[model samples]
Structure formats: structure tokens, C-alpha cells
Target: MSLSAFLSARYGRGFRDRAQIEAHHARAFALFRQRVMPRSPFYRDLAQVPLAALPRMSKARLMENFSAINTCGIRYDQALDVALRAEESRDFSPMIGKVAVGLSTGTSGQRGLFLSTPRERALWAAIMLGRFWPSLARRQRVAFFMRADNALYRRLSNPLVRFQFFDMLTPWQDHLSRLEALDPTVVIAPARILGQLALAGPRIAPQRLISVAETLLPEDRAAITAAFGVPVDEVYQATEGVLAMTCRAGSLHLNEGWLRVERDVIDPATGAFCPIIHDFTRESLPILNYRLDDVLVPDPAPCPCGCASLRIARIEGREDDMLWWPGRAGLRLVPADAIRTMIACLPLRLRDWRAIQRGNVLEIWLDGAEGDAERPLRDALADLGRRLDCTPPELRLHAGLPPEPDAKRRRVRVLPA
Candidate 1:
């Protein structure tokens, strides 16, 4: 794909007319379907099939049928072996021939492996520069933090774009001096790690801040923004593909020009959707109607920036995090956003918090910078019970931080059935 042509098609022209944007995406989708459908044996039956009629794909299904589903013809066992070995060795330079292989964090039980060829890597870099970087002409420094390193990101380094990869697994203090010395123009990291960085209050504030991997909480955003003197922008990407990104107005919008997003609506009243992605740019590992379990809230009104892409107000927690309880009628799943909002409204300040639903008991963990969070915690539970219209589950307050910074911090989680 030509970098100039791609950027000009989307950003330069500013496809502000909704119908025009839709027309552009429809053409791209048609081209993608024509090229990709015939190559894979798995999708042979899906040739000329309607997108909705094509069978839905999940992580488990993807992993189980990697060899067949992937057009690149990489074996599942071979890919898993290399990915696992790299994770253990902490050396991510290895690849499946020209394709870069990386493993998911496995916050869910089943871990996943993703592949990207050199061509795909270059395309990703070009698209990222167009979307996130302030300008193509100016030189910029970037510090990217993540658990696993990919060759796709390393390819971003150039004279114009000086990119540094910080390993999240390493001790945060080890890189403090480097961060100070680099004094990056833009900082990208997980929301949890960004909050930890905010506490340090580094002298060199970044002009742009981007949060990825985890859900960017309001409190976390406030803390980071206060420390850096810049509003936090979010990139809602997954192992699946680069999905949505924050606009100039700081509103998160799906990259509809490159990817088609279908709303698998779970809650009609709240307008919450589980995103089903169809990425035209992904040729090696074609992602079509690949559904994600995470819940996202869609904004009905147009954004102030007037970008015609699909607008997402906020990303709620994952589907597994949504607490389900047996109500008078049937099993009811508590809205993750409601649970978070209720906790955030508490009278006392919470340094960090988490609620885990194990069977009928709701175990609460609250870390307060101040003294005695017990009273406030109890009050929050009382309010939560009233909102859900169910008997309060046995509330267990753990001694330590709600979710220790060392691990994946989930606001809501339900034990496996």
C-alpha cells in the first residue's frame, strides 16, 4: 500500500461526509474479500458469502485452527513453540521466516499468537505515523512500553521518528534514568503503568500521551493528565489488530476507513457493543468478522473533530469481568461501567480498587492513600447492592492493594463457571 495514497485517502481528504466514508469502506472491503477468500482452505466455503453469514471467529477457534485459517500457511504447533520460547528467553527478534511472531499476555486462560510480515509492519508504521504523530515534517521522540516486543514496532525507528522500546517486565526503576535522559516528545504505555509513572512525576513532561492494552480509567487519566500537563489519548488496539484511536478532540473513534466494525449489541438500552472487526489491511492473517469479548459504548452524536469514523464514547471492561448473578427471573450480568462508576463515586479517595465475583460473594479490595477505607468500602457495597437489586454478596476486603501494580489490573472479574 502506498503511504501517501493511504494517508491522503483518509486523513488528507477528511472524509467528513458519513455516506462518503461508508462508500470508501465498502469498496475496500470488496477488494479485501476478493483477494483473501480464495487463498485459505478454511474460508473456501465462505467464497462470495455474505459477511454476516460467515461463521464468527473467537480466540479459541483461531488457536485451534491456526494452520487452516491463516493464509500464510504457518503451523499452529510450530508457531506456538517459537512464540513460547521467545517469551521464556525474553528475546523477541525471532520470526517465522519473514513474519514476526508474538504472544498475547493471556489475561484470559488461553494465550494467543499473532503474526505480521515485513510488508504488514511497514504499513502499520505508516498508518501509525499518520494517525498519532503530530506532524510528518517535525522530528519526534517516542517511548513505547509493553510486555512483549515486536519487530513491527522496531521498524518505526527512523531519523524523523526516534522510537525506544521499554520492556514492561523489567523493573520500572531500571528505566527511570533512561526516561529522564530520553525526555521523549510522546509517551505510550498501559494505563496502569502510566499511573505509576505519574506518581514519580518526571521532570520532562510529554507533549502527547497514549494509553493502550488496558482500559484507561477516568481516575488514571486525571492523574496522568495532571502530572504531564497533557490530556491522555487512548489507542484501543488488541492482539487482533489496530482498532480504534483517539482523535484530535480526544474522542476515541474506530478506524473505519481501514477496518469495518460491527456492533454485536449485548445491551440495547445502554448501546454497549462487543466489537467484531474486519481489517482489510491484514493480508497475512486475515481478520474478518473476528469478534472480541470486550464491551464498548458507542457515542450517538458526532465528534467535535467531525471525523466520520465510528465514535466510541468509552471502552467498558471485558465480558469475563462483567459479574453475572442469578436474579429472581434468570441470570443477570451486571454492567461493568455501572460497577466502575459506582465505585468511583465513593466519598473517599481510592488509590486503586478491584471487585472479584466468586460464586455469590463479591470480594472487594481497596487501597487508600489515607487511613481507614473500611467505612467507605462498606458504603460502596451497600450502594452497589441497591443498584443491582439483589442481596449484597459477602463482601471480603483484602489487606493489600486492590490489584497490585505488578499484575494485570481488572476492575471487574467473575470466576470461571
Candidate 2:
């Protein structure tokens, strides 16, 4: 493992200001240009170009040119074959030589393929182990829950750390017994599954509970904390990499050390923006000037934990989850947070709810409601529309919640127009 990176992450100096952050980015990008970009056939010729001048990347575009974009020269078709085969066989281990191949789906169900090398995996292990290993003095058991296991995580298995992967493809109820058997010190899973585990009241008392893969709503966090009696921590990650993590102050801090983040602000009032990332540490697949679909609201105040890194108020879900309504200026953005808050503030205690915009209608589903919710909810939407200076989509109410998918939970969604 990368002991130096581990030690540095745990006990190294942090940027106190923007100037220092820029300086670090300069040095990191320089190294990436000299060492990593030259290996990628797609980027080798453009190594000297400014990062912003380079072409942008997305999951679809990356998949289309995967053969040329990757430094390792692995063909997209071959990698897809291996990944599909592994999924079919229910095998979590799939690799190409020393590289691990992983398949991920976007919020809109778009397919994505990623590769991680041995050194990269080691560096990842170092950072995670250093930051959240619980205690070095005693052996720690870690239970990781995900749809598939990548070697990047499996590398953490050793004498001091008993790492187990709980495949989400199987029935989670069945895994509860196994989870109790381990009684892990650290539990990691999507926010929904974590909530499920909490409701099950697993006898295992974990020291740390990490929510990943899905958006962690305030309700989910409350449920988890009430069950575990510990503050719920979050890891805001995508297939791209570990974009952000919770600091000691319990705020989400951008991982400014590994990459440079440029904002594409959509709302100046809230300072809500889509992040454009330039990752220097990823050598296997060059991610330069890449735009992600996730929205983030920046926290201007410095973190009390002494981390000078950029802090975020919340992850506003994906662009697809945002509701758009008719406005004088055109379509106005109705963020997922607004919809969630509206539902939360209502007098009715809803066990579950979802808001989906389709065509000219906004479909709302409510669970465990005692009285008429349609009128109050419709009024709330009208009020929200008035605030935004837009017309809310037509409201359609349903009695029960939507069917649960086998993937991440989405409480708000805006279907394609």
C-alpha cells in the first residue's frame, strides 16, 4: 500500500487559502501532463493544450472512444464482455492483467465503464484506511455493500482489516444474518440500504456507518443516527472517483487535494453549480475538464475542522432529478432540495414520497397519510411556483409510494420532455 499517501492524508498540511490550492493544482497538472497524458492515445497529442481547451468528456463519449482514451489500451468491447460475463456469473472479481474493470450506471440508467490500476488501488486504500480505519491498535472488521466489488476495494483485505463485500444483487434480508455474524466495526452501504439495516435493528453495533452510492436525505440520516446512536457520515462519490467526503466537522468537503474543481454556476443566488473536474491522479483513464451531472451548493464559510478545502451545503442530486417548470424567462430550475423540503414541512407525516415531472404533469406519490394531502400539496406547489416566478407542472396524486428499484433511491425525477 501507499504508506506515504496514507500518512500524508491523515497528517499532512492542508491549503489555507485559494492561492495555495492553485499552486498545488499547477504542480499536480504538470506531473499529469508529463507522466499520464502522454500514455493515452486520445490525449497524447494534446498534452501541451490548456486544460479548458481540451475536449470535454462524458460517460457516453468516454464509452464510445474507450479504446483510444484509456492509457492501458484496453478495448471497450473486450472490457464490456468481461464485465457482462462477471455480472452474469455473479462473480465480483473481473480484471484485465493488473487492471480492474468496473461497470456503473448513472442516475438516468446510462452505462459507464471504469478502470483502476494496482498503484491507484493502493493509493485509494491508503487514503481511506488512513482517514477511516477506526483504530490501528486493534483489528477492524469492515462490511462494504455495493452492486459489485472492485479490486480497488478488495485490496484492503488483510490481517488487521477483515474486509467483506456484500453484493447488493442478492436479497439484502439474507445478508442481514451475515452482517450480524461479522458485527463489523465499520458499515458502508447506500443510504437506502443503511436505512433498511437500521429498521431491521441488527444486533451488531458499529463504530462507523458510511452512506454511499445514493443521496443521503435528512430523513434517512435521522433514521440511521437514531438506530446507531452515532452521527451519520457520508461519502459523496461517483464512478469518476471520491469527489468529496465528510470532515471531522460533519460537513462535506471537496477533495481538492486530488483534483482541481471548476464551477459552472447555474444559480447565482444559491451559488449552485455543476462541477467540472480535472483529475491529475487518475492515470488509467484521463479525466480532464470533465463535467458531471451532479449539482452542488458551495458553502462560503470555512470548515470548523480546519480544512481549507471547499465545503458544500448539500448534493442537489443529478440534473435529471431537477424539476423544470414554465417561466417567463423559459424553463426555471426547481431543485430537488426545494421539493423535499416542501414535503418535509407539511403537517402530514409521510413515511415515503416521490415527485416526478412528466410532460405537463408532476406526479406525486405519498405513503402513510391519514387525510387529504392533495389540496395542501397542490397549494405548496403553487406557492413554490410563485416564489420561482414560474408555473408548477400539473399535479397528479397517488396513494402509495412508487416501486423500489434494485439500484439507488431517487425521490425526485424530471422525465425527458
Candidate 3:
């Protein structure tokens, strides 16, 4: 579908002009307010304030009122039951058309259930296709990587487009074999996984590469782009949903039609956001002004891509992921991304490293390197301390790094005494 036609259908033709986007927002917001206030008893009660007077909603508040927020005819308990059954049966789309329900594979402690309407799904697909492959012809194959096989992949099919799913949990050799067989034009996967694939060097080739799920670390980005011989498009998607995607110029662009994001900049010391979200596409569950637990920094400049949609720099890990360090005043929480950046900056030989915090002491575990590595790693850790305004505590180096049981690896671990 043409962008103009899509915009007209969603926000009316008047909104096609850049000047009328706000009017479109206003109209959409009004409809959202009306729908949620009456239909969603959960939101109505939690959002005691009138729709006009309601401030941005928070994650905590949404969880607290989880039962009352769903506008879909299904009850919360019923939906949960349906979701669990669907998940077990491998029929993930059981509740899709009636009420778009999808399970969040929560790497973070809390697993969430997200819902949307078929209309929202269609809009999401259209915006995604328009933004990501504006110039591509109808016939193209896209290879997607995720931990589990999903029924949602079927929703992306069209007569001209084909999508192949690659399971990340499967062995790397298996993926390589599948990729050789598929020969997809486009490839999408997490940055770390793609970096691992890049280590093989050049057997896999695609016209375009897209990174999603995790923050694309600079070193990994450089390596993958070099290996693939194509600029890597980083997509800012999370369990919450497909938040945003990068344009041709590599600027992260918000999916304005699917959702609206309000960023909360938290002081690392206090692991909480000020809280704010104005989700317009949430009908099954009213996500009005929810506070996301994740930390993010809003982009300071408008994207050169010409879309007015607001964008954010990579999500710098969740609040709980921050490592605690001993400080003169008290214990201070340091963002894990800071440590990751420090490690990335170091010129040390290492396969993988994990930072573990126990009370006042910090432990650094190294996987592929040994004894002589202390100097550079220590210097990097010391530099991180300086940047975070905390003293460099004793760093204990482990001979080997241990893996976490979960499929999702924890780069930083906080251990209890």
C-alpha cells in the first residue's frame, strides 16, 4: 500500500501533510480516550483522572490494574489461560484474530502478555515494509531469527513475499546449513548472534542485514557490517513489541503508527523511570501512559530520514540489570552497558566476559583468556569507575566463566551473599 493511502485510512487524507500529523494524533487520542474510558474498566479505574487530565501511564500502574485494562471481550484470566494453552500446543495464533495475543519471551525477570487488533497488525506490517524496504520489488525473501518458532510468521506472508524463520537456540551449524539452502535476500537477528555468524566469514551473504532484540554494540556492528558487505539495519524491538526500526540511512525511526514512546531518563543510582507512555495502537489492552522498566535516551536531533517520529538511542539495559558498586556514601547502581562499553573499548584478547557483583566486591570472569590479562581489563574497569563516579572496588578474575541456565545469557550478574 502507498504511504499516502495508508496514512489517509488511519488518520484521514488531511493528515498526509506533515502539518496535520498533530491533528491526526489529536483525533486518534480522542478515539483512544473514548474507547478505553468506557470499554476498559481496568484503565478507567486506574486512570481515575479524566482522559484529558490523565498523565502518562506507568508500567507499575498497568501491572497493578492488569485485570481491568483489556478492552477485548476475553477476561484477563481467560486470556492468560488461552495464552498458556496456545503456547503449549504450539498453536500460538489461537487467540490472534479475535484478540491479537502474543507471549513475551521475557529475558528480564518479568514476562508480559501483549495484545493488538488485526487492524493494528496490518498497519504494523505495512509501516514496517514501507520503512524497511521502500525500494524493493514485490518478490523478496526475509530470514528472521528468534528463539522459538512462532505462528506470527505466517501473518507476514503475501503472494510476492516469503519469510523463513531461523531458530537461534538451534546449533550455529544448523543455521549455516539452513541459510545456505534458503539463500534469503534479507537477514535479521540479534547483534551478538550475527557477530558469531560473522566469525565464520563470508559463507552467508544477503542483500540487506537487520539486527534486532539487543543493542548493537559498536564493535559487533562494525564486524557484522564488514562480514556481510552491507550496512546493518538495527531494529529496536523488545518483548513489549516491535518498538522501532532503522531507516536506509541507519537512523532509528519510531513506529509512530503502531505506538508512541515517552522516554524517562533515570539517574542510574535510582533504578526507576519517571514513567510515561501514550500508546495509540493498544486496544486489546489499554497501554495509555505506561512506564517502561527499560532505560533509554531520546535522540537529540531529528532523523535525516525525514520522518518526524521521535527516536531513541539504544535501550541501555533494564533497571534491574544495573550492577551495584561500593561507594563512600552508599552503594551505587552502575548501568551494565557502561561496563560493556568499557570492555568493548579494551584491546584485550577475550572470547567472553561477565561482571558479577556481590555486596561491595566485584568479580570479573573471563572465558577464553588467562593470567596476563589483568592489566588491560583492570584499566578498563578503573576507567568505568571514574566515569560512573564510584571507587574501583577489588576485582577478582575467574579462570573460567560459567553459563547461566536460561537460554538468555546474563552479561552481568548480581549475586546474593
Candidate 4:
């Protein structure tokens, strides 16, 4: 599927002209407004305000009124039941089928259920193929890192594409074993996990590497590409759906055809935003003008890749992952990625560390050799604390930091449970 052909089929002739993207967006928004207003009482009431007068709906508001948001007959409680059942059965196709329901992994304490129509799913699949592998016409094997395999994967009929699911919940060693056997052409996993794999060295050589389901740290990106000898692309997908993806040039481009992303700037000091997203692809549960807590900065300049869609320089990690440490006045939340960045600058002697917040104290655990290992790590931690204007908390040393059951290693965690 060539980009031009895919866009023409999906958006008609207007897609070729750059100005028509906004025009297409306006048309899709109007159609979404009409379909959702009558079928979904939740959206009807919320969207009652004039299109020009509608206030931004925040994440808190969406969660509060989740049940009423869906146009489908299924209530919020019912959707939860259906989603859980589908996940447990590992046969999500029947529950989703022509409908698209992707459950949030719930790492941030709030799990969300997103619903999309068959048209949306097809469009999504087409866009993904068009963006990622437009050059490949022959059959290509893809190793997908997913928590649960869904029917959507089973039903995809592209003779040139074969997808193999690699469960994220399994141990890394086990997944590596499976990857060795599959010998897939493409590898996709979370950025942190991909970094770990790179550190372990490559057992399989894949032509393409993709990171999804989490933010891709700058350090991780370099490591993955160096290990695989291939440029690593990022798919900015979440429980909400596929939001954006990187082009061949490694620039992040918005999925403009399916969703309208309105960016809200964060205070440089606070680093928080209320993102308003209008999901044109969602009809079963219309997420019209829905606000997200995730923070992002829209790129002002055109991408070097020459894609017409909007670009984002970075997709900062989740809001909940922000670190809160005690100060003289009270507790303060700081961007956790900053700590990770600082640690990346230090020598490789300090292999891994995890931050845990308990009461007024933040504990930093260092996992590496004993002598002088703690010194550089502690200095780096203190420097980060000083830069963030917060006093450094307790620092400790450990033989090893246990991995989360889900196979994700958290750089920052809330403690005192």
C-alpha cells in the first residue's frame, strides 16, 4: 500500500493536498459529532455545548463518566466484564470482531477500555502497513510483543505478512528463546525491554525494529539500533489506540486520519498538560474532545521525512511515573525521566537502579559492583535532586533489582504501601 494510494482510498482525493488534511478532519469531526450525539447519551450531554463553546474535557472527567461515553448498548460495567472475559479467554476477536476494544495495561493505576468500529480497525491496519513497511511486498514475519494475543492478529489476511505474538508477561530469557526459534524479520517490544535485549547482545538478526507500548528513551534508541544494525521505529500506541508512529527518518508523526490531537503546553517547571483528543475512529465509545494527562510538545518545523502529518519531538512518560520527593515545604512531583537521563551520562559501572518513594523519603537502589559503584550513582542522584530543587533522599545498594512480574523494570515507583 503506497502512502498516496492508502491516503486516497481512506480520505479520497483531498489527501494529496496538504491543506485538505484539516478540511478532512473537519468533515470527520462533524460526522463523529452527529453519530455520537444521538447514540451516546454520555457524549451527547458533554458535547451539548456549541462546537466553538465546548470546554476541554480532562482525563479525570472521562474516567468519572466512562459508563455513559460508549454509544454501544454495553455499559461501562458491561464493557469491563466483556474486556476481562475476552482477555482471560485469550480469544478477543469475538468480543472485538468488527469492533475494536483494546484494554489499557493499567500500569498507571487507572485502566481504560477503548472501543472502535470495524472501519476504524481496517483504516488503522492500512495506515500501519503503509507507514512501516510500504517497501516490502513479499511475506514478512513480525514478532509482536503483546500481553495477550487477540483475534485481530488471527484474522489479518495479508498474504505478505505473518505476525507472531510474544507475551510480555513471560520471562525475558523465555522470550529470547522463542525469538531465536521464530527468527522474525521485524522485532517490536517496549523500549526498556528492547534496551535489556540489546544489553544481552543479539541472538537474532531482524531487518526492522520497532518500540511500542511505552516511551522510548534516547539512550535506549541508540542502544537498540546499534545492537540490531537497523534504524528503530517507534509506534506511539496506547490503550486509546494508535496515536502516532515514527517515519523511516525516525521522526514521530501523528495518526491524523483517525484522530485530532490538540496540544496543551505544560509549565516548564511542572511538565503537565491536558491533551484534548477527538477520536474519529471511535464510534462504539466516542472519545470526542477527550483530555489526556500525557504531556507532549508539538514540533513547529516540518519533519525531515517530509510526512504531511503533525510531528512531536517527544512523548514523555506517563503522568503517574513522575517522581514525588519530600521537600522543606511538602512533597513535590518531578519528571522522573530527568533522573534516567542523568544516570545515562554516568559510567557503565552502575548498571541498574530503581527509585522508590516512601512517606517523605525517596530510596535509590543501586545494582552493580560494590566499590565506587555507589559513589558515582549517589553523586548523579544528588545532582539530579539539586537541579530539580529538591533535597536528595536516602540512597541504598542492592545485589539485584527484581523485575516486575509483567517483565517491565520500573525506573521509578511509589512506595510506603
Candidate 5:
């Protein structure tokens, strides 16, 4: 079944244009309405309504209406209980009957309960393994680093695959020996963790390194690639589902075959938009017109892979984290990439850097920065502000790096004072 799901996802959709993708969505949604929507008490009545007419769903809204939304008749409170219990015990084996219940990491304001049936889990594992599998002849060892384990991911373990889960709560330094001992052929972790592992110089030379959960920055990719002698690949997945993955050409492409993506543009200049997704592949929970807070910058240039799916240039941080500087006409967004470029051009060789905006203040932290490095950075930012027709945030320069977060590592952030 896993192999069949893999073959279908990898080769079934020979989508070559926008029309083909839309036609696919039409057929998928038709089947979904006929087979899946009637099962869901919440969506049963709204089955006939146009997709655009459906209410936009957020994490909070979904959790609030969880009992009615799911086809499995799982109550919100009951599901949360199961999810929380597994989180506390660190044993993800428990499930609400045949459905796997897991809690989202809650980066998007509220924690969410995600459900997957046996089939859903199989399809997920198949797509991942089929697309990113290094080789089929050899039994591959996979070291998966995650904040919490879910039975959904456990499906990847079979006779041909050795799957090892590393709990993120454990000290990373302590895992080094076990990691070296395992000698995994594929190492998967959050981007920052992968970057640190690259620097740690572990003996394991993985053929493939996949970055998940967190945004992969330019520096992180460069370091990981240099150390491992393999280009860093990415899997942009959320509790929502697998949204996108890196193609063989090393470009990030949306999984348009499994879902329909609608863009809500936030930064027109950069073509940066928050994605509104309708995933027909999810039967346990129907995710229609689900608006994610993540900002994605689209690449207009065509990918060499010729898949014709939308290629993503980068995943900008959350909408809340987008830096908005005061301008004469209105608030102007300061792209995180711009800040990185400004710092990169600086005379000082920075070991590390972080930019944080709070109200009218921008705090800049630099490792290996001396007092002399401040003036040049300040000048560069001022120049940028002028170019953007905005007032530069009051600069607060610090000489040392900020303490890294235990969860996802965001190099740049914006928040209230």
C-alpha cells in the first residue's frame, strides 16, 4: 500500500500546466465531496457551497469546532486529552482508536490537534520516502529529530528502513554519541539543529540532510552543504500536512497534486504572500480554505525540473514576525533578506547575527562584533530606511549573540515592546 501510494504521488500526476492542476483539483474535490464531506458533520451541510464561499479556518477556530469538524466523531476535549497525555508521557503510541491524534507545536498562537488515519499516515510516509529516498537497493537508516513523535511518522519504519527518533527535549550534546554510533544514511532535523550538527563535525556522513519544522537560512544551508558534501534539502510541513518539498533540482515546489493553494499577497513588491490551502487529501479532517499565517515568497522563474508547480524562493517567517517600519505614507515592510544583505556587506566578519524589532526599536545582536562594527551597521540600515522611504527603528546594537530558543530558531523576529 505504501509503495503504491508512493508511486502514485511521485508519478501519477504528470501535471504540466495550470489547467492540468486545476482539473486535478476539480476531480479530487468532487471525490472528496462525494466520499469525505458527507462523513464530516461540520462540512456535510456546506458540501454544495462553492469552495470560496467556505469559511476561512484558523487553528483556534478548528480547535473550537473540532468535534463537529472531524468525520471520526472525535470530540475536541477528548482528542486534546489523548494528545496531551502522549506529550507528557513521551510515548506517542497511544491513539484514539485507529486515528492518530497529535498536538501541534503551537507556534501559530494556539496549539492544534491533528488527526491521521492509518491510510493517511501511509500516504504521508510513502510520499516522503518515494521523493527523498536516497536509494532503494540498500536498507536506509533514518535519524529523525523532532520535538515530539507521532505514530504518523512511525509508518516510515519497515524492513527496508531503520527509523530512529531523537527527542528534541534531550540535550543535543548527549545525542552525539548515539548519532555517530547509528551512522544514519539520512539525517533529518530542524534547520538550526542541522547547522549546529554540521559545525559539531560528527563522524556520520549522511548522504541526505533534510531540514524540517524551521526555516532554512542561507548560512545554515551553506554550512550544512559544505560539511556533508550534499545540498541541503527542505520539507516545509506543518501539522496541517506536507505543503511543499524540495525537488531534485533543489528548488522548493508546492505539492499541488495533493491540494490547491490560493495566495493572499502581503508584500506585493516581493510577491510574498500567506498561503490559503485546500487539502483534499485529508479525509480524517477536511482542511478547506485554511489560511496559514506563514509568509511565502514565490519564485517567478521556472524550475528546470519542469513539474510546473509553483516554486518558492523562500519561506519568510510568520506574519507577526514581519518587520514593519514607519514610512511617510504608510507602514513599509523591511524584508528579512534585506537586513541579512546589509549585514553581509558590512566590513566585519560576523560569527552570528540576529535582528529583532520591538515597537520603534530594532535590536541587533552580533557575535564576534567589536564596538567598531556598530557605526557601519547603523549607517547601512539608515541608508536602507531612506531607500524604502521609512524611518529606521532606533538601533540598539549588542556585541554578543542572543540566546537560542529551545524550539525553532528564528534569526530575525518582530514583536511588541
Candidate 6:
């Protein structure tokens, strides 16, 4: 499909009402099922199967079944070798023929390799430009900060758009001067780096600031907006596919226009759900009924922008971030959102922080303001304890926290098995 024509038809729908969104999504889902079920061996036998009856796919399952899981016939071992070499050499142009090959940090402990056809890459770029670009007609200088790179991300560069990839492994301080020099019209980075950039003043102004890869914590968003004087929009994407993004009104709306999401409820009361995503846009690696570990909370109210796609209230860190401790009867769990809420409710501006649960002990790291950290810290702990209905874990405030292992930083890490 022609990029311009695809964008016009896919995004021009305006998604004015819920009915329209549903109609668009249904058509997309139906087309995807019909196309993928026949072509992909992973899904061939299930052609006549209902989606709900299909076994859910996960990162582990995908990796184990990698060869069969992909319609592209690319071997997992070969792809991993290529992706790793690219990362090591800092040259991402190499691909499995015309396909785009990229590696994920393996946020869940196992590295993931993703493949995309040339057509898929173009579609992704077009979709990104269509959804996130400040305007279609106007030229844009986009600075994308990511740990790795691929031809897919670079494909958008042209006379109309200047796309630059800032490697996260490189010294960030060195890039500050270049950042000021580039004067990017749009800046995209993980939430942590975005916060860091915001904190590193004589601030550079950008028409648009987008947070990707990491959860856009409320505190981080507030800080970015305060520093940049621009609304910090977010793109909710993963190795799975481009799942969701912020609409014009700045609410995070699921990209239900091109993907269908099945909510696996973790907590109905909190509106927290683990999504089973079926991405119609991904042909190389069709992600049908694929389950992810991340947790998302849906907003009940309709967006002011009138985007009928499922709107998200917040992206809770991860399902694994939930802490558990032994109680009289059994192990009691403290929801990840509860811990996040406690810290967010505190009066301090959390510069950088991490919460790690090691058995019955909770290790808290804070790197903000010098004054006494105990009072507000204690209050937050009290709230956490009250909510969990158990004595809070031994809270120890450490002076320094460990550096992040990858581009994706988890504010909350659960260490105990």
C-alpha cells in the first residue's frame, strides 16, 4: 500500500465516535485473522479456531517457538546473532534481506529479537508520523533517543523530516551540546532520560516532547512539562508492536485502530489489566492473542478529544513489580500501583528513585532534595502498610541506587523469587 494513501485512509477516519472506532478495529482484526491464519505456520492449524480459544503467547513462548512463530521463516538463532552484532558494532543497517531485524533489552530477563518486512517498516514509520507528528505538511527535526537502532527508525528521514538516533549507551553529557545545536523540533526518549534532559538546564525547547520505552510516571510527566513548557506526549509501544499513543488531547489512547486488545484483568477494582494484543499491522511476526507482562489502567471517561479508542488512565510499571509477603494464611500481595501511589503522594520531588522488594524487606532509593527524607518517607510507608494490612517491610533508604541495566528502567523491581 502507498504510504500516503494508507495514512489517509487509516488515520483520516478521525475516530469521531465509539461506533466508528469499533467498526474500524473490527475490520482490521478480521482482515488480520484472515491473512495471518493461513500464511503463518504458528497460526495455520488454527484457521478455523476462535481467537479466544487460541493458547495465549508470551515472551518465553515466542522465543521457544520463534522459528514457527514468525511467518518470515527467519531462524531465531540467526536473527539473534545478527541483532547482537549490530548492537555491538553500533551499525544497525544490516538486515535479514529486505527485512528489518532489531533486538529488545529482554526486560523480562531473556533478550528478544524482532523482525519486520520492508513494507511493515514503512507502515510503522507512516503510522508514527501520522499519529505523533505535530503536522503532516510541516517539516520536522525528530531526535529519537533509544538504546538500539534499526533501519526501520531511520526510514523516516528525508527532505521533509530529519531523523537522528541518539544511542543511550553513549555518554549523555556529550549529546547535550549536540541537542542544543540540533534544536530538535521534536524530542523523543525514554521517560527517565526525558526527565534527566528536563533537569539539565538552560533547557532546550522543542515543539513536541515524546516519552517512549518506559512508563511515563506522573511525576516524570509533571517535571518534563514544567521544564520544557510542552505537554509530554507518550507512545505506548513494545517489541510486540506500536500498541498505543497519546491523542491530540494528550490522553494515552490504545491504537485500537490497527490492533485489538483483550484485557486480562489483574484487578477489576483498580482497572488494572494485562493486555493480550493482536496486532494487525505486524505481518513478519504476527502477534495474535499475545500476552504481555506490563500492566495498564483504563480511563472510564471518554476523552475530550473524542478519540473513541480505549483510553488509558495510566501505565502501571509492570505486573512483576507487585510485591508479595508471607502472612498467617498465605502470601499476601501489595499491588505495584499502591507503592507508586504512596511515593507519588509524598510531598518531595522525586528526582530519581527505585523500590526493590527483597523477601520481607523493601529497599527504597531517593536522590532528590537534601533536607530530612524520613518524615514524608515514613508517611508513605505508613500508607503502604495500611493498604497492605500488614506491617510494612523493613524500609531502608539507601544513599545511592544501582545504575539501570538497560534503556528501560523499572522504578519498581521485585528481586525475591
Report the candidate with higher TM-score, 1 versus 6.
Answer: 1
Estimate TM-scores for all models: 0.92, 0.96, 0.83, 0.82, 0.96, 0.91
**CA lDDT, candidate 4, residue 279:** 77
Write the residue-wise lDDT of candidate 5 on 248-364 in tens digits.
888999989788999999978888999998999999988999999999999989788887899999988899889988899888888888888898889878788899888889999
Decoy 6 TM-score against native: 0.91
Work out how many backbone clashes candidate 1 has. Answer: 0
Instruction: Rank by lDDT, highest first.
Output: 5, 2, 6, 1, 4, 3
lDDT of each: 0.80, 0.87, 0.65, 0.67, 0.88, 0.80
How many clashing residue pairs, candidate 2?
Answer: 0
Colliding residue pairs in candidate 1: none
Tens digit of per-residue lDDT, candidate 6, span 1-417:
647734753466457777886787778767777887677887888866767788788887888888887888898898999998998899999998898899996577667878988788788777777666777678889898999988888977878899988998899788888888878889989998888898887447798898988888887799889998989989988889878888777888888867889899986557688999877778888787898988888998988876678889888767787676555545565666677778777776756678888877788888774667778888878776666666777888876566775557887887763
Residue 236 miss distance in model 5 (angstroms): 0.4
Q: What residue pairs are clashing in model 5?
A: none
How much lDDT does candidate 4 score? 0.67
Q: For model 2, what is the C-alpha lDDT against the true structure? A: 0.87
Writing each residue's lDDT as its tens digit, candidate 3 over 1-417 gives 345534432333122333555666667777776666678865565444644346545444554556777776665566668778866775555764456566565565554666767665666566556545523555777788876544444455567668887767567777877777777777777777788778976366677788877777666778888888888887776545666767555777666655655556566433334335566765667666566666665565766655666556555565666666767667666766678877767666678788877766788887787447788878888887777677876888786777673555567766764
Query: Which numbered prediction scores highest in lDDT against the true structure?
Result: 5
- lDDT tens readout by residue for model 2, 170-232: 886889899999999999899988998998998999988889899899888998999999887
**Per-residue accuracy of model 1 over 1-417 as CA lDDT, tens digit each:** 758734853476356777987798889878877887777778867867877777788888888877888888899898889889988998988898899888885567568888898888888787677667765668989999998888988877878888988998898898899998989988889998889889987767688889988889887899899888889989888889888888778888888867888889987767888998888888777787789998888998888887878788888777767666665755555677767887787776776777788877888777663567667777876777677665566778775454442346777787743
Worst 10 residues of 2 by lDDT: 400-409
Better of 3 and 6 by lDDT: 6
| Worst-scoring 10-residue span by lDDT in model 6 | 5-14
Q: How does model 2 score by TM-score?
A: 0.96
